[model samples]
Target: MSRENSLVSAQWVEEHLDDQNVVLIEVDEDTSSYDKGHIRGAIKLDWTTDLQDQVRRDFLNKEQFEALLSSHGVGNDHTVVLYGGNNNWFAAYAYWYFKLYGHQDVKLLDGGRKKWELDSRELTDEVPDRAATTYVAQEQDRSIRAFRDEVVAAIGSHNLVDVRSPDEYAGRLLAPAHLPQEQSQRAGHVPTSVNVPWSKNANDDGTFKSDEELQKLYAEVGFDESKDTIALCRIGERSSLTWFVLQELLGKKNVKNYDGSWTEYGSLVGVPIALGDEPGQADGKSA
Candidate 1:
């Protein structure tokens, strides 16, 4: 029984426990979570260490970033399957990064590892000791990612999506968790961004809403789904979740995740933003 357009079930993964091509990468806030208990044969990749190649602040160096993937046994040929032992937080981050670096086949474990454990799936505490494989990371695709400068430049050129909540998009709210800052850096959003909360796509169980619901939901926000949309959140992780849904699920033509997200935008001096019912919100020129 094939899932609509998703990956295998934990039951199916259990049966294919020995399939060589199926490489499971359990990405959690801490890689040690993988050492505690995970799918019997999964590999542990901590979000900070393996997934992100942090610069002095929060930037990624292309060369160094590519090297990390090769060291993690994630080569171009590998059918990389990513799941988060934690909430889908960092798993979506890694999933987005893998695709940006040119690995088209990388797939997120639908519903994440939580769904698997809830079913009493088999797990192992012992860490797998496989030799790291080499991956030749292709040049990063600049199109699928957006930085502060790019967002500023593309203000009116293309569709910019603010995947954060209404408050955050308006600069009225600080972060998704709503942490306050003393300095109060760059407050608004990209000039042309439209508010489309990334969390709106998921149900209470954290699974994606039905495609029909998503279609109407996206359309309600002034998105066509067929057009190119660049989604951004606090740090790009949440928006990546949207990217996965749009590109892989909705079969969108040119959906990109602004991995730099609000962390990069909100700090910049002039990017433009909206509050409540502004004249030009991310929904193109206001409602």
Candidate 2:
């Protein structure tokens, strides 16, 4: 069996393309990219369709998750390698969801699709045939996910990181250009949450930074082993990248992703929200 870690380089994936035990998944917000060209034999997993609960504002249930995986020929024993466009935002989000459902052997392609393109690697339009297999996913792990009430209760006691851009964090923009519906009635971060854009965790080439650099980046924001951390973004997609960096790269054990994120938290009635560029405060008032 091939040894697996939280991340694997593009070259590593290239060498493992033929490994029957390794399943390559291309998870992207834009499925059109997969149709154009993708890593050879890679199966496309559309983040919006395959992973999400179409009617609800949550991920698919355990049975739905299993069906999705089985249809993609992903048995529990296979080493799932994921990568995609938009700096691997949805890819990392998928990684987090896989873990939440207890898929132990999941890994992300280092630098994601950007690094792959930069290296001038081979791409193919031919989709390979994959046999369906029975996949049993563990029950959804609530420990890694935080609900809006839990976030509200932990307001002053826990560490919350808002991994959106400065404009969104400052209440200047409702949401990103592409996801207009993800916007909240109120435009701001959760009260007392720190603004630490998720992009800081990666290099310009889309690769994650070195351990030393990652340590410093979080330390600057007072991330310590003692604090139980919760991270959020527009709809909790981008923050999954931060969640992976903190938990997988930094080895912080008590980190959770508030998947409900700003859309749910900011729109819900009676929830106290913080606005503006200020770093810390319990309410929208500047600290």
Candidate 3:
């Protein structure tokens, strides 16, 4: 997908605010962020509740997704524009979800809430009243999703990108510095995976770096642009941004986001785990 189609500017969103076919959505790591204030007419989707299966540690089923979208007034043909805080971290995750369910028109608001606030754009606590529609979602598309088995098989072969902080990649922390350091039984990253923090892809104002810069960023990390790639983090939200960069912005075809990520892989029994920075050795030992 071209960047023109997958990414939209704040100005574009403002211009299309009155369009009946465009739906604005806000998804944030902090679910309460939307309740404080959001772009006018934008609906909120709580990543912790709305996007996940309540009982299982998986995403919602097809029927559940259809129900969620239908309840949110999202139609099959609506153009979904997602934005949220933290450089659109959770927003990108929601965007990936839309693609996995075969939504034809979905785009991210560039820079997300960060940029919009920086520009002093309008925000409101007033929630819009939208009529519900029967939103039909397609069966889950497995092509863009990578499971733990695939991640293990990709060792030293596919491009395994560890999009986390240096501390997490080096086994110094289990999660981001701000979040609670918990989840996995083990620390460190997958074998042969390079540490490229997802935050590097965004500018100070939260806008993504230019395509040229993004290409160079991965090139410097020894990513094989032509090879199949799997991006991972503590969970999967952060890596979804990188997935969008490689697949949507750069137009690479074979990139997938490993949503199971460290939380699943690090806790697996007898699985090879690499420690320290610099990708470690291919044998999954500490560097």
Lowest lDDT sum, 10 consecutive residues, model 1, at 1-10
Question: For model 3, how does the per-residue alpha-carbon lDDT over 91-188 read when each residue is reduced to its tens digit?
Answer: 99999999999999999999999999999999999999999999999998899999999999999899999999899999999988888876637998
Q: What is residue 82's positional error in candidate 1, in angstroms?
A: 0.3
Residue-level lDDT of model 2, residues 1-287, one tens digit each, is 12137999998999999999999999887878999999998999888888888998778999999999999899999999999988899899999999999999999998999899999999999998899999999998887888888888878778888999989998888887566645428888888788889999889999998889888988897765677989999788899999999888778878899988887887899878777887657765777
Candidate 1: stretches off by over 4 Å: 1-6, 30-32, 57-66, 85-87, 178-184, 225-227, 277-287
RMSD of 2: 2.2
Output the lDDT of residue 228, model 2: 91
Candidates ranked by TM-score: 3, 2, 1
Q: What TM-score does each of the candidates earn? A: 0.84, 0.95, 0.98
How displaced is residue 267 in candidate 2, in Å?
0.4
Which pairs clash inside model 1? 189-273, 193-282, 194-282, 194-283
Candidate 2 versus the native: TM-score?
0.95
Looking at model 3, report the run of 10 residues with the lowest lDDT sum.
278-287
